[model samples]
Target chain A: MAFINYSAREINCKLVYYGPGLCGKTTNLKCIYERTANDAKGKMISLATETERTLFFDFLPLALGEIRGFKTRFHLYTVPGQVFYDASRKLILKGVDGVVFVADSQEERFEANIESIENLRDNLTEQGFDIAQLPWVIQYNKRDLPNAMPLEELREALNPTGKIPEFEAEASNGKGVFETLKALAKLVLAELKKGGK
Target chain B: MSLTPQLVLLEEDQRQILDVAERLVRDANAKAVYLVDKNGQLVAEAGELKGIDTTSLASLVAGNIAASGGLAKLIGEEEFPTHFHQGERDNVHITLVAQRIILAVIFDDRSSLGLVRLRVKKAGNKLSELFDAIFKRAESELGDNVESPFAEISEEDIDNLFSD
Candidate 1:
């Protein structure tokens, strides 16, 4: 859900990064936190286990400048991608305004990618949100890997509808990170514009 | 097309919420009080906020509530309406108001949990009424012919935000 505070003249939206375990969901958030300017971003909080895997979620509050005089702030979150953390994932999606599914591109991880998407669908339904109607995008991450599957193959398998926006990213180096964010933010803003229409 | 209700806080309603929060802070003898949306957005806050990071606190509080609520369902309860965390120097009392927002009170050794809880019950009732009115206004406004502030936004405007 988006929060529009006319008193503060700010628009706040929540966006979640989701995928299978070790699919670079947290990497995507870390890259954004490192690259954003200090004044444009708030402290990034990560609740991770001792080994650095996300235990609950990673949160980054980013100010993406102003639109129509209201400061647009995006709260970026990443679900624990590990399958057993399904409950945690549902909690994070409670008031989500948008979703970015970070699919691992390695050929060996194709099955995991499919399972994660199915899981995403089921979880969204459980939360009373229809995945197709939400402003969501897909990111083919780890594109630099030697075992990375072809983009076309991944798309055919994952994005059968060929409607949602997709980006190829190597999140560790920040490639396509901002592009994917910009696209999702745009879609969210467009949805907000269509209020009650 | 968004199925979820968007939380829109107008100027007038914001002031009312802050007034209640300020009163709660004084009555409970607490260090600070905060009204946060279930989505982790800080709605209004009062008292000593100088050293506090309200943004991070709001997000963490919402996460805590969410996790706790999930636990409640696991044990066959509808929800856990109240949560308290005590520390050596400071303590917190969290209550779910109207099932849509969180009212949190942070206190120190100066105040007791009993006092905070008593005051929070009254404050929560007032807040619930205010929020109920706010939601009604939002629904009516949506039904009216008022145009959205974002109606004038263009693709170029969105692109300009990322131009830097």
Candidate 2:
């Protein structure tokens, strides 16, 4: 859900980055945190294991300038992608305004990617959100890997609809990170403008 | 089970909420009080917030509540309405208001847990009433098909935000 404070002249939205384990979900957030100007970003919090695998989520708050007089603030989050953390993932999606599904482009992780997207759809459905209606995009990460699957193959499997915007990204190098974010943000704002859920 | 997409807080609504929060801070003799939505958005805060990262606090508090709520369900309960964390120098008393917002009081040597809990209960009730009224107003406004403030937003406006 979006929080619009007329008194403060600010609008806050929640965006979630979801994917399978080791799919670069956390890396995407870290890249954005590093690239964002200090004044435009807040502290990025990661609840992860000692080995740095995400335990619960990683949160980053960004000030995406203003729309009209309202300051547009986005709270970005990434759920722990390990299968056992399904509970945490559902909790993080409670009030999501938009989502970015980061699919690992590695050929070996193909099945894992499908399983994760199915998990995403089921989770959203349990929360009463239809996957087709939500403002979301897909990011095919690890594009620089030697064993990465072809873009068309990934799309044919994951985004069969071909209606959702898709990006090819290598999050560690920050490629296509902001592009994915900006596209999702634009969709979210457009939804708000239409006064739709 | 679909949740509302937007929680619109108008100026008058904020004043009423802050008034309740400020009074709770004084009556509880606490260092600070914070009201956060279930989505982890900070609705309002009162008292000496210096040195406190309110944004982080709000998000963590919401996470705590959600996790705790999950635990409650595992035990066949609905939800835990209150949570207390006792520290050597300070303590936090968290309460759920109308199951929609969190009312948290951070207190130290100046106050006791018993007093903070008592005051929070009263303040929580008042806040619940205020929120119910606000929701009603918002729903009625929606029924009237009031124009969204962002209805006039242009693609250029969105492009400009990312231009920098």
Candidate 3:
């Protein structure tokens, strides 16, 4: 949930990145951490295994400057995307304000993408958050792959509801990364404007 | 369906929370005291926080408490009201207060966990009362004379956030 502290005049929101294993969820966060200026960002913490796979999560707190007179801070986190880590993923979604589903674009990983999306929907539903009504965005990551799936096919299969904003990205090179974050952040702010907080 | 949980702490309420946190540090001789929402948002902090990332601490503490809550439910318990972590140098004691908020005390060799827990118990009650009053005030005045702070923010203002 987004936390608005009136005493401090600050707005804090949690945004989680989720997808199947090796879907570049963690890479998306690392790219943002590198590109952000020092003054506008905080320490990036990764709880990972020996091989650097996210064991629990990767947290990066970014200050998107300010809006009006209040400081607007976004806490970005990535859930461990391996299928066996479903329990960890559910815990991370507890109070999430927004979500970015980073789908692997390789054609061979199509089924994995579908299963992960289903997993996301089921988990979100358990938390009483309907993805259709939540501030949601989808990133078809790893677009630079030789045999990446077509954008239309991916959209049809993953975002069949056609209600979410989607972005195409090559996360390692930092392409379309900010655009996805900015879009989701905007939606989150819009939701708050409705007194949804 | 809620974008964020509105933390409507008036200046006086904030002062009260800070005062209690400071007392917790003094009585327990702890390194720092942090009050966070169950959702991982840092509500306030006190004491000599030199190298601590309070934001990360708040988030991770909330996560730990949450996972513990899940375990409690699995075993047919209402909730695990408290969790204690004993590190070599610094030990942390986390307790639930007012249902949705958590109070955490980080202490070391200067004081024992018994002292910290005793101080936390007293301070936690004071905080619960303070927060309860704040919530009541928000409910009464929220939509009447006082509008939401975000009401005046324009689309341009939001768009400008990412311009740089």
Best by DockQ: 1
Query: Local error of candidate 1 at A182, Å?
Result: 0.8
What DockQ score does model 3 reach against the true complex?
Answer: 0.54
Q: Return the interface RMSD of the candidates, in order shown, one decimal each.
A: 1.8, 2.4, 2.8
User: Which parts of model 2 have CA positions greater than 4 angstroms off?
Assistant: B140-147
DockQ of all predictions against the true structure, Cα-based: 0.66, 0.63, 0.54
Candidate 1, A26-132: lDDT as tens digits: 88898999999999999899999999999999999999999889999999999999989999999998889899999999999999999999999998998788988
lDDT (0 to 1) per candidate: 0.90, 0.91, 0.87
Better of 1 and 3 by TM-score: 1
Clashes of each: 1, 1, 2
Under CAPRI classification, how is model 2 graded? medium
Residue A122: error of model 1 in Å? 1.1
Per-residue C-alpha lDDT of model 3 across residues A115-195, encoded as one tens digit per residue: 999999999998788877889899999999999999999999998878789999999999999999999999999988876
Over the stretch A1-197, how does candidate 2's per-residue lDDT look in tens digits? 88889899999999999999999999999999999999999999999999999998899999999899999999999999999999899999999999999999999999999999999999999999998889999999999999999999999999997999999999999999999999999999988877732
Candidate 1 vs. true structure, TM-score: 0.97
Per model, the share of native interface contacts recovered reads 0.64, 0.65, 0.55
Q: Kindly report which residue stretches of model 1 are placed more than 4 angstroms away from their true locations once superposed.
A: B1-3, B140-147
TM-score of every candidate relative to the true structure: 0.97, 0.97, 0.93
Worst 10 residues of 1 chain B by lDDT: B139-148
